[model samples]
Target: MSHQTGIKANEKLIKVFGKSKNGKLRVIKVSIENEELNCTATAEVKKDWERDYDKLIVPLIEESVPCYILYRLDSKTSLGYAWLLLSWVPDTATIRQKMVYASTKATLKNEFGSSHITEELHATNKEETTFDGYIRHKQDFAAPAPLTSREEELVELRKKEINTEINTDTRHQTLGGVTCPMSDATVAAIKDILNGTYDYLQFRIDLEEERIHVSKAAVVPLNELPRQVPTESARYHLYLFKHTYDGNYQESFVFIYSMPGYNCSVRERMLYSSCKAPFLDDLNALGVNVMKKLEIDSGAELTEDFLHDELHPKKFVNSRPAFAKPKGPPNRGPKRLTRPQEQSF
Candidate 1:
């Protein structure tokens, strides 16, 4: 026995266009070839194209005219093919109309009666509201309310919690040692604790029975750290000794402390040593020699040993022979005049 079978296929939906009361056109419907009311376009208007009664009005419609049919939804009457929607036309402003509007606005008030409109047109072409004005408008719409006493207390508590968390995180990250002093917020918090705003513990450093106690709450401010300002002692010293014997010493000390090496105390001691009067004098002497070699100054204190070691170390090693005076030829007496000279005259 033979049996008959049926087959089915999916179909594509055709788009239907409609016009609004404001004269703006929009897509109305889309459905399968045989299906009714299968899908409809939402209220969102397509930004790039406008749908007229039975046609899509696009910028490129002039290039190739496509056939389109319009249908009335209620009456189901065919409106016929349309190339361009009569409602969709170029919007043009007349000079008189522009002048009338420009005369009222403050921005264009001066340009309304001017001889040339180019200047005013250029100025108005790039007009835009500033960010500050937009932000002010936003704030004006939704202003916050004043906090109550309890709310203020709660805010203070939260602030303290946040500060504590930040401090803990910073300490954990800098477990070895701080590269620099504490920031303003951390310093202020420490100062508050030190001033008895909050209770804090003390740490003791014992050295040979002498105990030096420092409060954990008290922290040096960031401004007190070694900074790049000329007024800072370390920076000032570094500047003065930059071309001197202490140049390398100061650089090494800053690097050692910044990197937090094992011998930090030794580096600190060396820095203090360089700041002494005798060391500073030696550094100044070296600086003077450097300046002299550069032909900038002749008053540099050029000691014999300094000149030998620093200025001409290699030349001093291979001592060149001193220049000797050259011997002159023996002097000769004047010759006596002969009798032939009288004949020549």
Candidate 2:
């Protein structure tokens, strides 16, 4: 995600991009502070602005510090004044700094009016911060090397592959194929669970055939639910929780979705996630009223106690003593009065 500009940065940018500036604002250097972009320095256009580029911009950047430089180009377009966005992420900078600067570059340009930014120059070292280096960078982009016949074929093939993948996925999703269709066995297992023939039911996606199949179905006890979860893949579990809560015998249909953490591939995770809601809907349509839903990364977390806590959360009754009003002082009897005796001279 992109970071936003700080208040100071926004205020300074308004002046730099606005028409009220009386001074010749040539360059504005921006830095990241507390994950927000703020203006660190600004340079005014001097008589020899080209010669002073290094003196004005290079000093603000460091070997370990990443910064952004907004330099006003001499060329002006019909939209407004053309500006060059310089992204200075040095090689010695931390990984986090590099990521933040990269993500925030677009935001900085957008806030300052993207139309005004005619070109962008990325620099990683002191040498690239010079005017000559920027010219060379522009030249390299202006005229790229020509591709050979084989390379051209490979490029076309790559484009076709991407387009085909996207179109196929879109077609599948539109036709409700992204969430694999449930097989007959899977549907039968779901029915068995609803009829109480099975206490637990689990499903797995067969990616090759693009179908969901019943991987496991048995009378698993509440305590053994954790053992039934697959350790290396994602599965959907439907369990019948029959427990007595507060002397009342209760039976609830619980749905537990478990994934074996990052060990599962991204494709597996995405497929499971996309199929979850539709699978649950299928169960519900078949008369399985799931009372509770739980999502977990590991099966070990699916203990009986965890399910109990989730199904019947412990209610806290305010046990502190209530405030008591103080009693009024008891009525006192009238006191006798005495007069002082006069002294003789």
Candidate 3:
């Protein structure tokens, strides 16, 4: 019976026992199937010897079977080839495996050949299992309905809360409730240092106060600020204050601390104060300045003032130029004057 079949790339076709009409084992028609392309071919064998059949025809047939090639073998003499057609066999795993085994035996007759093949098979299986497990895990994660709306909302809220707490705590730590000392001596010392009058000196307590006030009043916010730890052990807070072009104050503050018995250097202190503290101070100063600039104490006042300024102006000036008398040039081209002779006529 004929059967329709598909073939694979690595399938093998086997030759079953068959005979020709001559009954002399003459016409050997080998039937093989191509697994990949699902085609068929017939080859005529020249010899009926098993060794010769295994050597040439078997290998070719085995290789072709899995690759979608179907074949029927025929017998041949010195003059020409003849056929002893046989029924086609379906390509099966057992058949292919047998063909592979035969081919391996034919090719690798050494004792270690079988062992090497076995090791390869074992390795392949192990890798297959590993790959399968990975695929399964990936599929599990990709499954639908992992998170419900409520769960997603909760996650987002948690993240927001965490961020808020972090920011508040950071602020609290940096600007510790304790007021910084602002002494007169410290202020004078700071001024001297800034003026290049002194190379390096600690601010006296009295000067420090004056310095703080002057610095705070003239503070301008720097672009970048240093990070500070929000812990009780933190030693000092850094701040920056600068004067704006519009005569507004900008200030930033940062908390700073050094290890016990380790005083901060002048450069370090300057950097911390100029960068970190000033950044925070600037945010605060901006809010304050915005309020002060508009001359409003509250949002309500600001809105009222904004409307007043936008809707009406105290005085208005006309931009157009005033009319003036023409001067210098007289009318030219055609004269419009009446001639005395024409008038008389």
Best by TM-score: 2
Clash count, candidate 3: 59
- Candidate 1 per-residue lDDT, tens place, 42-153, comes to 2333443223221332221222111111111222113322221111111132222222232222321121111211111111111112223224444754678755656755
Q: Which stretches of candidate 1 lie over 4 Å from their true place?
A: 1-133, 162-345
Return the top candidate by lDDT.
2
**Candidate 3 local Cα displacement, residue 125, angstroms:** 93
Per-model CA lDDT versus the true structure: 0.26, 0.74, 0.30
Per residue, candidate 2 scores C-alpha lDDT tens digits across 1-345 of 123323234565566556413337788888878655677788787655567677777777777788889887666788756778889987566544655676677778766778888888998788898988887888888896766556755653453342345554452443232447887767777877777788888777875466787766678777777777777888888889998899999999999888888777655666777678877777888899999998998778987788889999999998999899986668865666989999999
Note the residue pairs that clash in candidate 1: none
| Clashing residue pairs in candidate 2 (N, C-alpha, C atoms within 3 angstroms) | none
Error of 2 at 227 (Å): 1.1
What is the model-wide C-alpha lDDT for candidate 1? 0.26
For candidate 3, the lDDT comes to: 0.30
Error of 3 at 160 (Å): 26
Segments in model 3 whose C-alpha atoms lie over 4 Å from true places: 1-177, 203-257, 261-345
